[model samples]
Target: MTNARIAALAALGVGALVLAALGAPPLVVAALVAVAGALEVVGQLGPIALRSTLRTPDAVSRAAAAAAALAALVTTGVTAATVCAGAAAVVALGVVWLEGLVGYAWREATRVVERLPGYTAPHSLGARQQVITAGWYLAVVLATLTADGRSGELVLGLAALVVALGTAAAFVLVTRAAIRAKATVTARIAQALRSYDAPVMVYLSGPEGTEYQLGVWLRTLERLSVRLVVVVRETALARVVAGMTSLPVVSAPAMADLEGLQVETFRVALYVNNGAKNGHNVRYRELTHVQLLHGDSDKPSSYNPVTAMFDKIFVAGQAGIDRYAAHGVEIPADKFVVVGRPQVADIAAAAPGAPLRTVLYAPTWTGFNQDNDFGSLDPTGPAIVRALLARGWTVVFRPHPYSLDDARSLAAIEEIHQLLEADAAASGHEHVFGDRASSTMSIVDCFNLSDALVSDVSSVPADYLYSAKPFVITQVDDGPSDAFLDEFPLARASYVARLKEPGSLEAALDALEHDASSSEREAMRSYYLGDFPRDEYADVFGRAVEALVASRCPAPAAPVPGTPGGAR
Candidate 1:
């Protein structure tokens, strides 16, 4: 049978099943099938993005027809089959009324708004439309079946209605033009197969939402090697990742599409988290995954499942290793190495003292949930920064990336700055300002120049443990606000301050500025950032890369059929 015939058969089969499930009588099912089928016909116009303005009338007509079909179903479901004809009329009227309401609402809403055509075109008939149509049809058929007592004629009528309606719906949706063209997938495969001159593989989470630390990591990787290929999502992120890494990058298609790419001698896949969503097979089977995950020293990570798959796991500190172990994430102790974050390492090595010290104030973004009360900086963030500046510290406001990008957040910062400027005593230094060009500065740089670190619950403080400098966390709330720091205990390296209480920030700054001891700094540094071995992570990293290449290149005792031809 032709593809069209198959499509029709599928639709008819589904409709018959619906009839059976609903136990609806014939006429009710027929109306629903028509509505559903009509919408499918309307869908032939193609995507809403490409349609012309003339499709509006057709769209309205289809919406009315579908709505009417639903009304018929409802009436039939509630009433007997003897009244099926009357129920259909009432249902059709209801659809007409809804169509009018929708049309009016659309016009009023879009009156001043310029609507490009095709916006409403695809609604002519789709899955959502069909679902409602089928539901209505089912309701009416059941009512008719119940009223007619499931007689031979009634059963045959219902079955015929189901088939006819289902066939029509299928023909509408699975049109000749709607046939799947495998050419695009084939082209994508071809693209993946092309040989690269020098390919560098970079694995990152979906682009755009990466932490500032990632920027530091990307920059460090590019400086060390030239042929960097970033494996990330397609479209907008490809440009951003390419721009950030300053290297040519390629995104991997689905796992099957990865078959053709030539594996580079230097290619390394990096993992920032232990999540399974990142595709276990693609990273483990096809590439050399370098796990530089994003989580802290809390709880067992998703990394446990695929620990054996990685070439190397770049850990933060002993605490990180201990935490992972405590949580049952098994790492081959020998393979796990403490490569101080390449990004953090770069930040640490930057010229120690800037002309003036800067305070990097960052906070996490409120997630999609309405319960976003947590993780806000003390309302007194600006006031506290002012207090620090009074004692001779330049505050560089770095709100969370989400907050920084949001218009309301930028406006709030501007308002706060104005509040500070209004006070003659507060405007003491040019250094107390938001770094407008923050997109260029890595989070590590923010840490490097900071004389004292001040933040609420953020991974920055955890990272700041490496600096072992005077640190202060605002006790924004008396309660679990400190859970993040308390759980890690690494935060005690810095003085903790309360935000709600008066003079808390001033007092913390005073202690940080005058009373911090070298011993304290050393203890914190050792705990958070372990000492680098041989003074060179590059040599260490290079060696790790070489080891991975050696392991993968030499054929194992037995190789799988689909495995990369073991470095031969």
Candidate 2:
């Protein structure tokens, strides 16, 4: 075990020894450790479900284990000291849960307010989960603290006990059912995957919500027939990939799915994004690993230190190559294969629609972590939209998908929507291209629909480089002291402005006025997205995968049907 785990165990042992020295029964000590262990398992679960934590079949299995453990802890009766420890631990667990979940609740209640899209998952736990953990913890505490030898107190305690027990039972039953249903889907997906032995496999073993990234990868990997398996983990992430990309998606419930499958069965296992389960899947020694990231950008994640874990890191351009080199990560130059933006080619050009000059205002969501806090939705987003509208240009606001994760981003989106709605009413033209579910559009579709783009530092702008269109980049106002992520490399070539005040607006207007960025676009495009002749990325991507396959397990040279010379 790591030092932290060892430390935690040592601390727990010291605590047990103290209780024993205080004349506590051995049973109490045992119960204390057991309850603490249960809480540890649940607490380590943090906000993200513990089972899905592995991103494997074990996620469901762990869910079942957690629920069962909670039930046993509640139903079992021991000495008052034992009950007190359990209750204190429950209360402590609630506090721990709150420790993780408080931010989620705070964000949900307060709403994340940013001039631009800026966010990360609740630093601790979600509001809903906080409430659940609190309720259970309080119930157990009330039951234990109020317990007495008197019949009246006993009766009241028993009633509290009932509520706690009922709650635990409900969680267990619900978790079991959910696990079973998930297993059914996973088994079906596994069975489907078992039939395919495609040499190139595009595997998505991450959460379901991230399937959008896989959709783009699927489009990038189009033309070549390959298996796009969504390995089942905590979220049925493969469902989205299956729906989006009609490719056969297999759910690997266990290692059994990969049983007997060797390098002969599958040559390359390309992961869309590195996930926790990805580390588990990588253990399969025979499969050649190729890391195909969602999009190529200058974000720290664009060239994570972990990318070195894979055999090959398929990059978008020299930018991706230089990004790792600059970070001083150990991935060699040879493993970095440049594959231009293939997904951009699939995004059909948007037709000019009811507008004088249309601009796609697509800002990225506040990042999930502070390392990539490059969203500008709070401070500059509204002003930028208004400025564009004032200039008689229809603004299409396409906020990042995760923009609605908190209140602040949602409010900003709502404000932008209101601006668009008001503009549409007066101008007789649709200002918001993405609002309702039907009207909700993809980044590529928005790229096609707009004349230009004004986005934050993200893949949206990076991919827009493919259109050779003029776009503006918005810088964040306040962030960490030492996060040096060049999210938008084009800022050096194109318009780069800050969201501190109305600077984003000024820069955007300048871009709209000048709009003539063919030279800049071509140069920056070549810089980020290498020179793809005629803009055909499918051939480039295909050739790269073919090379990977050839390197790992090349096709056997066709034996001259009779003899080498005779066939000729």
The TM-score leader among the candidates is 2
RMSD of 2: 12.9
Q: Which ten residues in a row have the lowest lDDT in candidate 2?
A: 109-118
lDDT by residue (469-499, candidate 2, tens digit) is: 6777776764431242253456765576656
Model 1: per-residue Cα lDDT over 103-147, one tens digit each: 322222111101111112211333433444444344334433433
TM-score of 1: 0.56
Find the 10 residues in a row with the least total lDDT in model 1. 109-118
Q: Estimate each model's TM-score.
A: 0.56, 0.63
lDDT of 2: 0.58
Candidate 2, residue 144: the lDDT equals 37
What C-alpha lDDT does candidate 1 achieve relative to the native structure?
0.49
